[model samples]
Target chain A: MKDYIQKMQTGGDIVSAITAFVEESKKINEDNHYFTVITEAQAIEQAKNIQKQALTKKFPLAGLPFTVKDGICVQGVETTASSAILKGYKPVFNATAVQRMIDAGAIFIGKTVQDEFGFGALGITQGKGFQAPKHPDDPELCCGGSSSGGGGFTKKIPGAHASLGESTGGSIEAPAAFCGVVGLCPTYSRVSRYGLLDYGTSLDKIGPLTKTLPEAATILQVIAGHDKKDETSSQEPVPDYAASLGNIKGLRIAKIKEAFAEGVDESIKNSVHEKLTELEKQGATVREVSLPSLKEGIATYFTIALSEASTNLAKYCGMRYGQSGSMNTSFDEYFTKIRTHHMGEEAKRRVLIGTFARMAGYRDAFYNKALKVRTKIIQEYKQAFKACDVLSSPTMPILPPKQTEAHNLTPLQHLMCDVLTVGPNLAGLPHVSVPAGKAGIMFIADHFKEEELFRTHAE
Target chain B: MITQDVLDKVAKNARLTLTKEEAAQFLPQLDEVLTHFSTLQDVDTEGVEPSFLPVKLSTEMREDLPEECLTQEEALKNAQSKNGYIKGPKSV
Candidate 1:
């Protein structure tokens, strides 16, 4: 991976690597690893552009070939969001993040697959149309979801260093954890959402999944910061994230008491505890922190997310930019027929729950109540952070389950899998899931304090 | 307590047509999950400001500027059907 980066940086023989990967990508299409590959001509032009930038001393990404989830728009390329409804859709403009990477001299390889509209926590929602590659160790196991192809693509291209993905719930982290890669879910609005398909607009965040923490940090540095196009984009200066890595000697780390309790996989729990002990030996302090409200995070997250999802998805009626010609007698019929025929079952489930929550008489009962509950949950996190510089937990309660079994989970059962992740997302805190022995260890910190979290991990 | 009817209703609101079997399967799970959430109601939050974000934040604004948007063709290219004005099913 380092050699690939260097080649891209130096502009030497990088085209071969890009070409070989594109060919291999075609053969490995079952993983839905790539929706489209840049033609050789396009790859050469991108390399030339990087070389020109390097000559001018503006090499941020140099020639690094990165892939983005299809949900994000790339000018002239299809942004289908892995749904058959928008199979041939192409964007006329690039998402802010995509444009930033391009200006930094990064080569766009292709768009990766994702759960339809990024609503599922498991890759199964990509539907039977796009096949995800099985786990490397266990063929029957899932590769993780929403960003399934984004994460799965990392394993396929030993030469392609990192990829960008979006997370609403556990998409990036879950897939990264299962695939043994690093995933960074930046603070909400740290990256732009403009030009990306929305699913739970308030909860969705764009992040990177990379082979190493350093690589992830590099990508984050490049793509982060304010965007005029996205109203929610933060205007804060993007921190020197890579510069913060080093001795974490005196940092304090807290492990949520509930996360390691009953129901967690024994092996994963042991691995996390062992990692904490190692950090302690390295001179860091570790303690147990109470975050009682965290137990309700998943429930609250679904209520809030699905509620927003219902509204965000309302634009996809057979009237605007998705599957059309499915029905036309009435607006409601058109919407029902198009959505029912095109959206995956998972998308439908969330939309229903969201709609019900916002229904006139029930809004105060469900949506307003969930918002109140969300506030309480956030307060719990703030208090917990005061006692510790960084909080640690297993990235997932269990490792990736079999795809068949995952598909069998009822919607509620599947939402339960997001238990460990929803807390950080609800709080809009910065978190990164790094390899912790055999399982994954997620380190979350106060918003805009990602540097501190990295320092704690390094120590 | 969540019932099959409630599950069905939620599904309908979500624009899903759940089979009777699916409603049966999901109802009990939703009940058990909500029972677990009931524990959170015990926490004392009186007089505490509900937290919306982990870190205190003020919305930051960017200078307003005119920008280009996706062309009608580019925007509608992915639609299954298009009439140049909107994307949807063919009109009878």
Candidate 2:
């Protein structure tokens, strides 16, 4: 991140930096890491424009090139969310976050691939002229997803600083961990979701996947603010997130016991424990804290996410937007056929799970109970915060699965991958996944407390 | 386990169509996903409020005022349309 920004400041040619970076990206992308790359000519043109502006004044992110996840809407560009239903659908406007990045002088290289409709965690659902992004470190390993491309490109290509990734249950952090980059999923309404294609309305958050903590903070500074377009966006004051990186002296850090519970790999647990111990050596008070409800967070997260997804995705029926079906048939038949044919297996499964969970007789048992558990989870976080300033956990329980292993896993097994990261997301706490060892440690802070996350992450 | 009839009803409600083979494959998978959720029943959430969001949210309404929106051409840009209208299946 600092590397790209330093180039322009040291009198280097912005166009040359971007052109070389795009070429490098293309070389790696040939291995199928990107869903789409802005044509070399288009990227060069945008770089030339930024060069002209550079002659006059400097912006915080001047000439930084980033990729938009396919789920994010970019005006006149294909934003497919890796789903065939919206394959050719080019949004007429940029998503609020995308527009903000452009306003900060960041160039949009192109959209990155992801799980179709952000459905799967392993990012195995690759379609629409692209395959799943290969893990940068190991091609044979899975790219933890649904923000797979953002994590892949940021780590694989230098001079390409950061990419925006939306998280619903660990999408941002999982990929960041697997790809060995840093990702911050701000408290649920910290960044506006005005332009992201809805996955789960309540759970979705737009964030940045970058190589360093400060870069994530810098990008967050640019994009985090209340937008009238997104009613869920907080009216809370936007702080200088990058400016608040203080030493981790005298901060209360809680190591979540459940985060290292049964299924987690021993190495992943040790790495996070080592980081917490190091913070303790640096004058931070570290203690073990348990959120019993953590055991139920994954299940509750899926229930609420899928239930909202089922209703949120109902708008994709062929009667309006998305892939058109047999128009000569009755509307019901047309809608059904388009979904059946164009939507992928994960999308179908979630829609069904969500539909049944919200059904009359079953609503009380599944959806309602899930919501109640969600409350308990939130309360648990609130209670834990009373005892500690920030909580620590492994960003992922295991290393990126082998590509073959990821493909062979069942749905339940796939969800188990999110066990560590989902709890903070469910509670709307601001968390940063920072590289520690093979995997990463997540610093989870109370709601709207992004500053503490950065301060702790710096240590 | 989820019965075939329940699976069919879910597909219909979701505006999706499924083949017999697809249904046969999904029933067991769906059953597995739901079985995972059975743990939620063990938690005593007796008097808790259903949490739709992690933070408190209040509905913020905007005044109905005219503003620039997608032009008709842009509105129908991604859909199959005729005469500037988005076309759909026959109502009959």
Candidate 3:
């Protein structure tokens, strides 16, 4: 594995690597790891081009093969957000991140499955009755997601070096933890979101899910930078992420008390605790810290994410975009019929609830209040950072539950699974979930501190 | 509780449609989610500003120089058109 990654980074012997990637990607697709796998012709064409470039120039991510989540558009590819509504929407342009990866000489093998419009915490709850990607650790377990297929494929496919995933709350981290892979959720706008289908504009971010922290950092180095097309992207300078991978002598790590609150499985907590103990033994100080507002992060995140989604998705009403509706009595009737028939129950529930929260009477009570609480969450994180270098938590509160059990959970119970992750997401902090056992440990840092986040947990 | 009446009003506001049976099924589930969101009432966010972005943000603009863009044919490629115009409901 070490030799393979080293050769990939240096653009050495790429023909065999590309062949292996295509073969392994096809094998993994048998288990439903991909929504659309790139054709062998496309893979070979890209590989031959990169091999020719290896004679003189060396790109940072040369020869690396990666998978993209379905929500991020790939040019000429069937880029649906795993929704029946976008049934045949092939993008005309590449997402800025995808284009950057291609320019860096990385090969894309396929796009992975996700929850429709990224609304569900459980990976199995897609609109078209698509099965969830099986967990790499235990085939019977649920691959926790919105980024479910990205996490699953990266964990199981040896040929693919990384995966491109998008997250609103815990979409990337949850599946990463469940599949026992490394997932990084960069600071908001750290990577451009110009081509990503919006889940929640204020909360959405594009990130990488990889098998190791170093590989995640390498992918980040290639993908993270401001783009002229994305107005919200930060002007902050991108750091040399790979340079920050060594020596932690006296860093303060804050283990969040709220992560161990009731309902978290004991074994999950013990696994994260063991990792923290090991860090402590390696000259790092571990202290218990409390962010009381973190307890309400789930509710606040949903209020904001759902409201934004209702507006962002309003453009897909079977008009010029998305699959066209046949019932054409009137424009309103056409839209109503199309959305009612094509949209899933989860999507309808979210749109209705979001419209309710944005209603005249309820707007102040729900949407406005959630925004204020979100402010408090950000402030709490800022205050926490004043004392600690990074905040630590179990990426998910429990291990990967069986798909049958996950299917039986109530809507609120499913949302509660993301309690540990939504705080960082709501605050737009840099967070990475590193595999610890069957689950993972998450480290969060202040905005634009991704190097610090990777440095503390690269072990 | 999210009653059928409430669902109807919300569906109308969102330009979406749902059957009576579907509305009935989602009423209680949506009500439970709203009830959970009620926990935000406990925080005394009296003077706090609403957070649209966690960090201070300002949009960076590019020069408005004309560049290559999609042609008329390419722009209309995804549409369901009757002739050269996009097909839609009859207007007055």
Q: By the lDDT metric, which is better: model 1 or model 2? A: 2
Q: Note the clash tally of each candidate.
A: 7, 0, 0
Could you give the fnat of all candidates in order?
Answer: 0.39, 0.83, 0.64
Docking level of model 3: medium
lDDT of 2 by residue, B1-92 (tens): 57888898888889888888889889999999998886787888877889878898668788999988878888888888888788887878
How far does residue B63 in candidate 3 sit from its true spot (Å)? 2.8
Residue-by-residue lDDT tens digits, candidate 3, B1-92: 56777788899888887777887777888999998887788789999999987778776567889989767666566667767766765433
What range of 10 consecutive residues in model 1 chain A has the weakest lDDT sum?
A: A30-39
Model 3's lDDT to the true fold? 0.84
Q: lDDT (CA) for every model shown?
A: 0.74, 0.85, 0.84
> Tens-digit lDDT track for model 1 on A127-214?
4366555665567877777788777778656665578898888888888887788899998888988888888777888999988887
Interface C-alpha RMSD, model 3: 1.8
Q: Which stretches of candidate 3 lie over 4 Å from their true place?
A: A5-11, B82-85, B90-92
DockQ of each: 0.37, 0.76, 0.65
Task: Point out the higher-scoring one by DockQ: 2 or 3.
Answer: 2
